[model samples]
Target: MHALATITLALAAVVAAQKVGNLVPEQHPQLSWQKCRISSNGTTSCSTIDAEVVLDAEWRWLRNANSISNCYTGNQWDVAQCNTTASCTSTCALEGADAQSYRDGYGITTTGGNTLSQKFVTHAAFSFNVNSRVFLLEPGETNRYQTFVLMGSELAFDVELSSVECAINSALYFVAMEPDGGMARYPTNEAGASVVTQFGEDNVKQFFIQDGKRIETPAASYPGFPDTSGLSLDYCKSLPTNFQDAEYFAQVGGYARHNEALRRPMILTMSISNDHWANNLWLDSTFPPDRAGLPGAERGPCPSWGNGPAPQEVERYYPNAKVAWSNIRFGPIGTTV
Candidate 1:
């Protein structure tokens, strides 16, 4: 799991660098979670753990450590502030978030229990926040990320999307990431705790919660796969998709390779975002503008311009949108169900 960078997420890609600017004063949010182990007899033992979260470097404020000038601004590096990559790394610091900063500056809030709410757009008197993403961290170690192995395990969590309008995505998932955040390999990666540099989110769940009720669509609801709601390698291969990227996914490794990633240790992440680059069309509307009438092209009812840039329709239209997640549980496969 990783911090939400810009709401405009890219296609599949690896963000490897250990964020050169994390050396500055940092503050992480305290989020609670529970870990459970189930016995063969169906008994369960659970422990409450205090966890922390870190914002992705992309969204953190990067300023010259000694002065008030910006180290990187307007999507480009300030050469005077950072003459070179190495120099910039040592000179700039990525500021961390406090309680007020987390809410007003990033639209993030948490309670005493296991819950985190991320807002799509946050507006205050002097500042504005568009979207947010954060990664889970180990309870005691601020620089270390918490890890989970989910092959035979199940993760249960309730999500409230009543405020998450169309074209908005409030997602949570697991990814294979180094527990130490690649700090050992990249000595300069102070914030490399979890930046998502490895395999993508192949093993994941996208769900919504309503009025605290269990919101679920039975596999029986889909006429195509009436017998099973689960997806496997066979299902992916049999499903027809002419998208070039989908083809490339098969050429590189396909679901088989992606499936194996689930057997490894993974980090959990969550976010509420909307696409500024693609308008999230790929997730909910006709993509490629040119493929409007093609099959698999018209995926949702949203107009091509449905979710515009943050300053446009997205912010102006849904300033009050948000998503709440709570009642999280993890245990043996059937135990949670």
Candidate 2:
């Protein structure tokens, strides 16, 4: 009787475990959404989506070349050879009018200190595209903008002030190409107001928290809050002195341009840093025609603009700026599971 009872209990325990799903910890669980409660209004909604871990390995350096056929064998300072498409040559050049000039004066390395494993470097001058997919709940819904919220933090090491330039700009930004080949940029204010106004482009979207105060994009309109414009410059005067020293995190919550979602593969370009010829100058004097001439140009400095250029850009020009980041993550905002 004792043996039979023990066997019966073991079978019951197995059934219980099956009912509760797998008890072991998950390694890279599939990304999904679940319903969660909204604290503000006590309404149940799906706003917090699970994110994927893209760059989590320790000391994982950003790849200098995109080519899978031919590896970059040159010195650390030499320009990397990239083959972006399967049909392109091993040294395939970017397809743009200014591609030649844009590819010059840049290099990448992964043998540096201060990263997850003390090795991190920026890709060459061209954009390093981090690709990802956006989820769609249903089909047959075209023209609906798919909104994504990117959240992560990064730290800079060995940041140095430029000896020749008054200001330098480093930025991590998102670029989505339109069906017609036009591109829309996020966190557009990376160049600050003087540059944006001088170039005649709309102030891009960005949000930051510094010194316990929230700084919003200048003269920008968000999706849910259509009637409200962004915060003014006066509110962001008291910024931190050393932006590189802190672990800065940004949350850009908004819909895509022209209702275009990232359902298709999109590129997240990290223009680590760019040192301009002078303070408040755009990194490149001649803005690309495709990027310039945006609407709603505002004439003022951005509150979130760092005092120094991004550490990555600083490394590019001075080779002294050291920057590293934890893995970056992206996903939908309203997912609850």
Best by TM-score: 1
Worst 10 residues of 2 by lDDT: 191-200
lDDT (10s digit) by residue, model 2, range 13-132: 222211111111112111222223346665534443332111111111212224322222232312443333232222321111121212221222222221111112324454341211
Q: List the residue pairs that clash in candidate 1.
A: 4-133
TM-score of predicted structure 2: 0.29
Total backbone clashes of candidate 2, pairs 3 or more residues apart or in separate chains: 14
lDDT (Cα, 0-100) at 132 in candidate 1 = 81
Model 1 misplacement above 4 A: 1-25, 124-126, 194-227, 240-246, 306-311
Q: Which candidate ranks first by lDDT, i.e. highest?
A: 1
Cα shift from native, residue 148, model 1 (Å): 1.2
TM-score of each: 0.80, 0.29
What is the Cα-based lDDT of residue 262 in candidate 2? 30
Clashes of each: 1, 14
lDDT of each: 0.64, 0.25
The runs of at least 3 residues in candidate 2 whose Cα sits more than 4 Å from the true structure, single-residue gaps closed, are 1-169, 175-205, 220-257, 261-317, 324-337
Cα lDDT of model 2 overall? Answer: 0.25
